[model samples]
Target: MDDLSRDIIRQKYPEFKEIPSQIANGTKYMPYFKDCNGVIDDTLIDVIIHKENQLCYKGRKETPTIDVLQAYNFDLLFTYVLSGWEELAHDSHIFLNTIGNPSINFPKPPPGKYYLVDKGYLERKSYLTRYHKIRYHPSEFCGANPRGQ
Candidate 1:
């Protein structure tokens, strides 16, 4: 499915081929969600491919094998940018990282609206509260919490 999606994107949007990483690693595609006010409403879900190799030797013969893992990476910035929601005032907590260093941060979106996200996006609350006119934090944590304390 991941490969099929990549092929479809490449066929539909030739410009994607220009992206260096896309050309090399066969494009990482993401899906984004936005609110009525044009603020980003969810993390961008991306499909990433992991490659590995295996080596085998039989007497005087040698062979190599390859493997792939269909993994996902969620990037906050990719959500807003891909959704064409830049019309917002750029003051909302529009971006979030769902893994590794779980964090969320972005400039205020607009005077009357803000982005909504989960608690995993805790890194930027201070700024969101101060500048964003309104922000919604979901009660659940949707990503890993490194500080398990």
Candidate 2:
């Protein structure tokens, strides 16, 4: 995170480590999320690009758009944002590029802390994602008894 962003988090959420009682008591996920600082995801935003550059921006979706990477804390406050990546760029690719490029100054989690990400992101040391083999979809878990563990 940048200096301004860090200051905002510090000022707004001084007790960042403290999980709210409601969330902690209501969900099993909160216990395992003690070390999670926030969540990260990328989204495609439609845009009207010049015809010359449209081809480069086109991806699986027919619409021309830019993929934007964003990070948000538990409070749903935006902590970081990276924009301008072409739609063709995958989530993992953007994440890797942001962290790998020193110039980008991607906010990295501190030691023992991590950012929760979806399976589209790399399963790296500081990124927490679900195991590929797990039945993660909500629909898959529906039934009288549910299915797998």
Candidate 3:
């Protein structure tokens, strides 16, 4: 990357140990050894991309926003991030545009490893996203569940 890009990235990400992945607590503390799960999600920062193009969702009026797609571990360390996406863009679209490549850009998991994600992502080999027809909330799971929720 050029100096400007490097500077931007430096500002966006913290100084971190360069590794593929690491298991939280294990003897084999090597790169690509970490678990990728639940920690992947996107949040909108206050900065707006569009001023007049506001949206109304549910019951609230939503303003234009800049979305930050972040991935963290159990320790809350950011492993991956993608910024500058418009608020109206879909999460799956962002993932596809950035990650759907013959030469994958994101960190690769081990043979049997996969990530835990929400329903926004497509059902893929390396991601374990939430199912479409399941109730994951505690209230929905109050009664006896034969599926062992």
Compose the digit string of candidate 2's lDDT tens values, residues 10-123.
324433565534346545556787777778898888989899999978877887988888887766677777788888788899988877877765678767778888789998
Model 3: per-residue lDDT, tens digit, 73-127? 5455556666766667788987776556534245544556666665787767877
For the record, the alpha-carbon RMSD of candidate 1 to the native fold, in angstroms, is: 18.6
* Reference-based TM-score of each model: 0.21, 0.75, 0.58
Q: Model 3, residue 78: what's the lDDT?
A: 59
Which candidate comes out best when scored by TM-score? Answer: 2
- State in Å the error of residue 131, model 3: 2.5
Q: What's model 3's overall lDDT? A: 0.54
Better of 1 and 3 by TM-score: 3
- Model 1 is weakest, by summed lDDT over 10 consecutive residues, at 29-38
Q: Report the poorest 10 consecutive residues by lDDT, candidate 2.
A: 1-10
Decoy 2 TM-score against native:
0.75
Score each candidate by Cα lDDT. Answer: 0.26, 0.72, 0.54
